[model samples]
Target chain A: MRITCPHCGERDHREFYYKGHALALERPSPDAGEAAWDDYVHQRENPAGVTRDLWYHEGGCGAWVVVSRNTLTHEVLGTQAASEARA
Target chain B: MGNLVAKSPCKGLLPLSVGAMSASEVETGAMTMLSPRKGQDGALDEAMRAVHGLGYPAPSGVESAGEARAIWFGHSSVLLVGAEPGQRLEEHGVLVDQSDAWAVVRLDGPGAEDVLARLVPVDVRLCAFPVGSTARSKIGHMSGSVTRVGEASFWLMVFRSMAETLVHDLKSAMEAVAARG
Candidate 1:
């Protein structure tokens, strides 16, 4: 697989590490209940279709990226810098 | 106070024969990493231009004037070589001393691209990489930042700790390419 990094352009997938879903970026409020925190930590919707996931360009630009892709076909629809995605 | 001496990471390995290509360490004094603070990219770019007469390069771009060059490191960061990153940029971002953190090497010769192709996965061809283009990619097993500086010339930077390994890898690749000729 090849990932098109915003800063590095198209690079081999070996250069990146999948960091689970992008939803992991959202954390529960400090005062939220245990159930809320638990859900945030353990709950993951492993949807087989299109999903937004996070990947780390550890071997390349060292930027965190949000990749919108199809889980089944491995088709990447788009990508954005994690900072920009969060913003 | 007593004086201190400078030592290169590729001390004995440099100037070594690598077939048609030669790998030499670059002494880039005062290398700095600049990352713009929140909502300050414009100000930082302006400050950089005012101080060094060079603007921050766009993504995957390299801007060089004389011996000084600015490499786009990531979305919000740049690596400044040759010229010192001025203090004014501090107001807009953080300045980091990277001179010792990275090892810079210049691979030059007619076989430079051939040698690199064996180790790097990116397309190093002139039409694909082009002069003044930079990218972060893997060189062998280590992460590297590569820039096409001139025809058949490339500037590669890797973590300081991996300098020796990188030199060895490049040498081996060069030798293999040379053997094919």
Candidate 2:
């Protein structure tokens, strides 16, 4: 698999470290309750189709990138810098 | 202070030639890392131009003015090579001395591209990675930077501690390419 890093251009997947789900960026408030914390920490959709996830470009430009891809086909739909994506 | 001497990272390990290719340790004088402050990108570029007569390089680009070269290090960072950071540059960004932090080696010859191709995953052919192009990639499991400096020459830099490993890897690849002749 190849991941197109926004700063480094397309590179082999070996250069990046996959961090599960883009939802990791959204953190629930401390007073949001136990169920919310549990869902945020332990739950995942595990869908079969398109998914957005975080990847650290460990061997390249050292950017955290949000990669949108189809889980079944492993085809990358698009990628954006985590900073820009968050904005 | 006690008497001390500075030794190059690749001391006695470089200036090696295998067939038509050669690798040598380069004297990278006073490397400085420049990282712009928040919302100071324009100011930093202006300072760089004023001080070094060169602007901050674009992503994966290298800009040179006389002996000074600005290499795109990573996101929002640049490495100034062969020159000292001026005081004016400090107003817009942080400048850290990095001269002793890296080992720079120059690979030159007809087989230079072929030797690097064996270790790095990037396409380093002249057509793909022309002169003044740079890339941060894995060099035989070690994260390093490769910059095309000439038509048949490249500058490769790795952590100072990895000098031996880098030379070993390059030597092996150089020998393999030579054996094919």
Candidate 3:
């Protein structure tokens, strides 16, 4: 698979590291309670359709990117820099 | 203190040639990494233009003025090569000396693109990656930078410690490409 990095253009998937869901960026506050913290730490939704996930461009630009992809078709819908992506 | 003589990272390991292609170590006088502070991109560009007669390069771009060149180094960063950065540049961004941290090799001659094709995944053809284009990509499992400096010349850089590996990989690719001729 090829990911088109916002800054580095298209690159091979080997250069990127998959970092699970993009929701990982939405961390709960320190005193948000056990359930919230537990969900934040361990809960994941394995949706079959479109999903937004985080990826690190470890070999190229070293930027965290949020990739919008379809789990069923493996088609990459879009990609944006993690910093610019809205939670 | 004992006398300490400086040694090049690719000492005795480069200046290799295989058929039409040659790989040689480049004496990068001073390499300074420029990363603009938040909201300081314009100021940094102005400072660079005033001090070095060059502006901040765009992503995957390279700007050159005389012997000095600035290569886009990853996101929000540029590597200034062959020039001593002025003190004014520090006010707008962070300037880190990277002269000793990278091993730069100049790959020149015919089939230079073919040699790099065996290593990097990026499409390095002149039509796709023209002169003055640069990219931070992997070179044979090692993350490195590739810049098209001329029609048939490319500048490749990796960490200083990987000089031998870089040379070895380039030599092997060079031989393989030449053998196909």
- State each model's CA lDDT, in order: 0.87, 0.94, 0.94
Pairs of colliding residues, candidate 2: none
Residue A31 CA displacement from its true place in model 2, Å: 4.2
CA-based DockQ, model 1: 0.80
Tell me the deviation in Å of residue B126 in model 2: 0.8
lDDT of 3 by residue, B31-145 (tens): 9999999999999999999999999999999999999999999988899999999999999999999999999999999899999999999999999999999999999999999
TM-score each candidate: 0.94, 0.97, 0.97
- Model 1 chain B — which ten-residue stretch has the worst lDDT? B12-21
Model 2 CA deviation exceeding 4 Å by range: none
Worst 10 residues of 2 chain A by lDDT: A18-27
DockQ of each: 0.80, 0.82, 0.86
How does residue B113 of candidate 3 score in lDDT?
Answer: 94
Candidate 1 per-residue lDDT, tens place, A1-56, comes to 88888778888899999988898678878999999999988888989899998999
lDDT of 2 by residue, A1-87 (tens): 988888889999999998989996788999999999999999999989999999999898889999999989988999999989988
Q: What order do candidates take by lDDT, descending? A: 3, 2, 1
Looking at model 2 chain B, which ten-residue stretch has the lowest summed lDDT?
A: B70-79
Select the stronger candidate by TM-score from 1 and 2: 2
